[model samples]
Structures are given as structure tokens and as C-alpha cells.
Target: MSWHPQYRSSKFRHVYGKAASKEKCYDCVPITRSVHDNQFCAVNPHFIAVVTECAGGGAFLVIPIHQTGKLDPHYPKICGHKGNVLDIKWNPFNDFVIASCSEDATVKVWDIPKHLLTRNITTAKKELLGHVRRVGLIEWHPTANNILFSSGYDYKIMVWNLDSNEPVISKPVKILDAHKDVVLSMSFNTDGSLLATACKDRKIRLIDPRSGEVLQEASYKSHRVNKVLFLGNVKKLFSTGTSRWNNRQIALWDQNDLSVPLLEEDLDGSSGLLFPFYDSDTCMLYVVGKGDGNIRYYEISSEKPYLNYLMEYRSHLPQKGIGVMPKRGLEVSACEIFRFYKLIPTKSLIEPISMIVPRRSESYQEDIYPLTTGAQPALTAQEWLNGVNKGPLLVSLRPDSRKQLKVEKKLPKKENMCLSNGFDVFECPPPKTENELLQMFYRQQEEIRRLRELVNQRDVQIKQLELKLRNLCMNTGSY
Candidate 1:
């Protein structure tokens, strides 16, 4: 007789989800009514930005993370897009910077003020115009600073370098034009060396962003992938889609070989699209479906039966969209390893759900809270564009480490106010006199001019390097 183990013993087996109280949630939010299947909210340790409905143009509200509860009806917004906003993402390196794409076929990068907002912001720090159709997806490079990727209905992906001090970038550094249909989802590998994408053409592609070359492609008649995610630290790719019989399904594939999936499992008969989020530190994957109230999580392993079902977090109110907080934003003292901000449009509220590992002791759990990707970038934009690949900087989540982070985030005494608990809690003092306000405006103008001059110099150097490279290729007959 053959013996087989039915269940695996693990510490995370008892992990459960807990929702925040009503007063802790954000209420009375005018969530966008657009039917796009994208997450309508973007969050970081500092702020929560949600796409809202507007009459004349597109706009999104940026609320301070700590200011939870009911919001005023006329709260300030960041309104500039001439069309409906499709997606928004916070820069991984800089919490004060964010990028948004819209049906206007433009991508705009905005810099939130160091202090809380008082009026609507109608200007963007930088505007990128490249796509000929409505842009739907935007993602920042995981390890590089000032690098962003965006895809649109044109079936092309544009890689932009925001490092340039220029106010507008008319041309992108590189373009990946391999997809024949709209790209559904994109994920980058651990070192940011490769990109995996799922498209509406029923194909999965692995591409080298540096050279605009497709490294590998796979398609299965049984699966129609809607979302793709890279399992960092593990050389595998996971995707969620639908099976031929209209059942939701998930599959795991080896990063190197895409001929066949390592495992494929059918979920249910739900028609809504599934969004997958992975936590590399805990090796946990959360799958949330659109128009559903349940969040299913699983543990991933490199051994046999690679994907193990952990449990599900069920709720009565369905989520219109969801935002995930970075690992640094989690509360280590409470044994919280992950958090989800669910957008409940029906109630006009955003609720916080904390995923905690059951523990009785008050001390920190070092085993569960391992070193995670920090808020620092590993490389600069120019280095990444020049064929450099690096992983994100890792930081310890110990209480002492968090205190040090808080100290580093301190602002100048003259411009500082205080928050009771949040890491970034500094306020800028209002200008007392008209003379002081004038002086501040002139200083900003001067800084902008200086940056423009620096950008011009950098552009000249880049052009010189391109000329030299072309000449070298011509001499070697490789052009």
C-alpha cells in the first residue's frame, strides 16, 4: 500500500483576516463609475489616491493615509486629465510622486505637496505623450528610480525615463511592439531583467525590455489568461484566467519553459476577472475576483503540488477595487503581515483588512516578518537603460529599524508639524506674510529653470552616446 500526506504542517496554516472598525474606514468617497477592470485605487505608506468621477475632466483624490473616516463633500483633487482616468500608481522610490494614465492618451506624473492639500491641483510636473489610443495600464520599475512602463489600446508598451528634468517627454526610450492585441497584464522578474505579459490575443509573452525582443511565447487552447504575476525569489510565473468552459482558472509556469504549465486548477464558474497579488517574503498569494466578496489565499512551494490552498477571507459587501499597502506600512507589533484596502462603492467606503498570524505574545515575530523590499531604489534610470539589472534593496522590519526610518523622514523644524502614529507626519507652516509667499514662489520658479538647463545638457550627452554606438555597429557590420 502507498501512503500519501493529505495536509502539510506549516506556521501560516492558522493565519486569518480581520477587518478594521467603521470609524477607521474612509467614507463618502465618489468612486469612479468607469467599467474598466482595473484597480481604481492606489496606496502607499503616505497616502491613498482614488479615481473619482468628475463632470468636465478626469480627476483623482489623494487623501492622507492617517486621515481616516468621513471626507468632506468638496475635498481637494488632482484634476488634469481631459478624459476618464484608467490607472494610477505611486512611485516605489518616492511616496510623494504618482503617475496616472487616461483616455486622453497621455500619462502625467504629479508630485503631491509635502503638506496636506487645501485646493485642487490642476497642473502636472511632467506629461508624456506617446500612445495614440486610450492608455489603460501603468507600472513603475520595481528596482529602478524614475523609470515607468505604460501600455495602451495601440498594442504597444512604452518605457519612459522620468529622470530627465524636462517638463514633457515626447519620445520614449524603448517600445515593445510585439503584442497583436490589447495587453491585459504585465509583470517583471526579480531583477527587472524580463517582462511577462498576458494579452487579449490568448497569448503569453516573455520579453526583453532593453532590446524590444520577445524571449518566449506560449498559448493554450484551454486557458484564457487575464492577469499575470511574477513570483519573485522563485523562478516561476503565475496567471489567472478562465477555462474553455467559462470557469475561472489559475496556472503556474516555469519562467524558463512555457511549453506547458506545471499545474493548472479550475476555480469556479464565476465570470468576473481575477486579480492576483503575491507576497514574496511570506510566499503567499492572494486571489481576489472582481464583483466578489471573498479573498482566496494560497501558499506557494517549489516542491510537488506546488500550489497549496491556505484559506479564504469571506465578506458580505463586494469590493469594486482593492489597494495593497507596501510591507513597510504593515504593523509589526500586531503581527500584521499583509493589508488590503477594499473599495466598497455601494457603501461609498474603503475598508482596511489586516492579515495577521495568530500569536499570543506581544514580542515581534521574526520568523513571519522576514526582510522585505524597502522603499529605496537599487539603480538609477540611466543605469537601467544602459543594460543594468539589479534587485530592490531589502530592509529589516524590526521595530528599531522602523524608528530609524521615522528619524530619516523628519522634515525641517520650520516646516514640520506632527502625526501621532504614522511614519510620515510632518506639516508645512503656512506663509504668514505676502512677502514670504512671494519669496517662496520665486524660489520655485528659479529651481524649475535650473532643472530645465540640466535636462538639456543630459539630452546632449545621450545623443552623443547614440551616435558613437551607431558608428561602432557600422564598422563591425552588425547594424
Candidate 2:
């Protein structure tokens, strides 16, 4: 074959990372100082949520995606957790819903308002209290709605089905007690049929989430695995950890047979933990170290030499954490294959880095932009819990196709739904006659008058309290 090619010739071989301008980045964010290896940031198309440092309780700031640049110091936050917030994940199916786990040994689900937040939200839509110790990890089921998995310091994994309207789930649907030590990381297979966990005990276990059974377990003597991920399409498991020599290493394994890795590569002897993020559509793997300013990426294939090094993107500021935007949220116009929100703790900034595939054509690149997982769930929580297995719904990335999908998503159904905390937004028929309109106006006027009276009463009470405080201070000679 003409002496065989020295390197693989692929369209993504020249992919490059582009950091967004300072004007487009989020600044002055008080990122959390927790020593946990969790990503401190989570992003969706609608908003970017970042865990922040707070007193008394844990809090996270939710900023509208379009409202970039310097954030307000007094911006509203979700501050319901009694302990430090460890991890937060947005529901794959619902953009307005998010679940957060904290050191308080509880997991809370919050319903975010569609509009910008104007006040602190101290209450969660639902609270889960099954963990006996601090919860470190929480993940939403990939293809199912209302299914959540949490791993705590108690070395137990709890699966919750949030199909019902209950505000609290004190009991989980299933509890997996396989790990003897703290769980370091977890990942679910393609249809979410199998769960893989890397634990502090130096073992990786494949578990059946529905039945709470351990399907497979393997531990390499030379590797201390810290993070794990499933290459859904390739039927492979990937991990990052340290070798016996304390050098960082990455391993790839067959999901069914983890006795030996298909490939193992040793990286530098950096102390920072490597966080691995893989894009199923593009077959790309991005490895970002916690305290490093460079992102090394590779192309994963099913053939020999499973991991092929592509390129590395370097920066001056190291990233404390990172959040990945979904494939659907990428800019197809810019040929952006992936986007990452890099959290810079020293500068208190969140920067968006877009990985672009340079193509001259302005037209949509159909080969690169394949039909990816859409914003719909393939199975309901009940269906999944009942042993149903299905892949995620896929949608096109073409402009016209995306517009059509958006239109279809906006079409309202017949059922009137109520969110948590009895928050209801009802669609009512308009007044049919002038008399009805007049009656509605009169009712509103009466309510306004009553509110004004309540305000006046509160004002008088405040004045009386001020007078009493002044007199008391004078009596004590403290004024």
C-alpha cells in the first residue's frame, strides 16, 4: 500500500480548539473550593450552572446562557443544601430540572424557572434522603426520564424513580451494595442497561442497575483506576488512573471481558487527576487534567491500536473543572463538533472552548454532523424500571431540521401539568364577554387594594419597632 501511511488519514485529524473571547466568557464566579474531583460547572442550551462558595449552606449560581461577561455579585442562587454541594446534573429530558447532591447526605431536585432568577431559591422540588453519608456523585439515566442514580461515601448506590409526584423519596427503588470503599466514578452503558463503577477499593464493577446484581468485576494490579466511562457505541470501557509507578495512565477494556485491557498507555507523572470526556457521535475522546492547561484528545476506533492520538490544546490558565455541552447544542454553522465550559478557579472565570473541524464549505457538513441524540427521552421511568431497553431518540443537525424539531417540541399537549412545590401555570380560556372582562378587572383591583393595605400594615409595624429600639438604646445609653 505504497509503504503504508505513517499516520491515519481522518477528517478530524486536524480538529482544533478555539477559546471564546473574554466578552463571551463568564467572569467573577466564586467557584467552589471543594477538593472533590467533580466538575464544578454544568451547562445546557438555556443556562450555565456553577457550584460556588457560600456560608451556612451550599449554593450554585444559574446564569442565562446568553447573558455572558461579568456576573452580578448579588445574583440569585439555588441555596437549598445544608452542606457543601458536591455534584449537580441537569435532567437529560427536562432542561428546567436539575438534581444536586451534597455533603448533607441528601440529594435535592430543583425546578428552575424559565425566566431569569430574581431571588434566592431555598427550597427543592424534591428531596431524596436515602444515603447515610455525604453523597458525592449523581447521574441521570441516559435514555430514561425521571431515573436517577447516586453514589455516596457510604459505599452504596441508590436508584430512584421520580415518576410519582412525591416531594421526598426517603426510600430508593434499588440499592447496590457491591463496593466496599467509596465509589470514585460511575458510567452507564448505551441503553443504560449496565452500570460501571470505579471505586477506591481498586476495582471496577459492572452492575445491572435494575436488579442490583454485579455482572462483572476486574482490577489490574498495576492500575489504580479513579475514573471510568463507557464507549457506548464501541462496547468498550475506558478508564484513567495511576500506574504502579505513580504515573498517569489510560486503559481501554472490553465491556464483557475486563480481565485484560485492549490497550494501555502511560502519560506524564502529573499529580492532577485526568477527567475523560468522550463524544459518541464523533468518536473523539478528550482528556483534561485537573491542574493542567492542556487538553489532549484522541480518536477511538474498534480496530488495532484502539486509541489514536489526535492533538492537544494548550492554555495559560489551568482548568479546575469543566462542563460539556450536548452535541445538539453545538454550533453546526461554525463546524463546531464539541464545546466545553472550562472553569478557571484562580481567575474565577468560566470560558467556553469550541472544538472546530475546519471546512471551507459554508453548507452543512453532513458527514461530520451526524444524527445525534435529541432532547427527548426514549423510555419513561416506569417503562425503564419494568425492564425496557431502548436507545435515545435521534435528531438531525441541519438548520431546517433543527428548526422543525424546535417547533415540534414547542407544540403543547392537552394535559395540564404542575411542577413541584405546587407551582402551577394554568392556561385559561379568555373572557368571552365584556361583563366577564369587567368582573376580572374588578377582582384584580380588589386584590391590589388588599395587597396595598398589607404593605401599609407592615410599614407601620416596622416604624413601631424602630421607635421601641431607639427608646431602648437611649435607656441603655447606647445610642
Candidate 2, which segments miss by more than 4 Å at Cα? 1-5, 402-479
Q: What lDDT does the true structure give each of the candidates?
A: 0.89, 0.89
Q: Estimate TM-scores for all models.
A: 0.84, 0.84
**Candidate 1: count of backbone clashes, pairs at least 3 residues apart or interchain:** 1
Lowest lDDT sum, 10 consecutive residues, model 2, at 421-430
Per-residue error for 354 in candidate 2, Å, reads 0.4
The clash count of every prediction, one per candidate, is: 1, 0
Q: Can you give the lDDT of residue 445 in candidate 2?
A: 58
What's the TM for model 2? 0.84
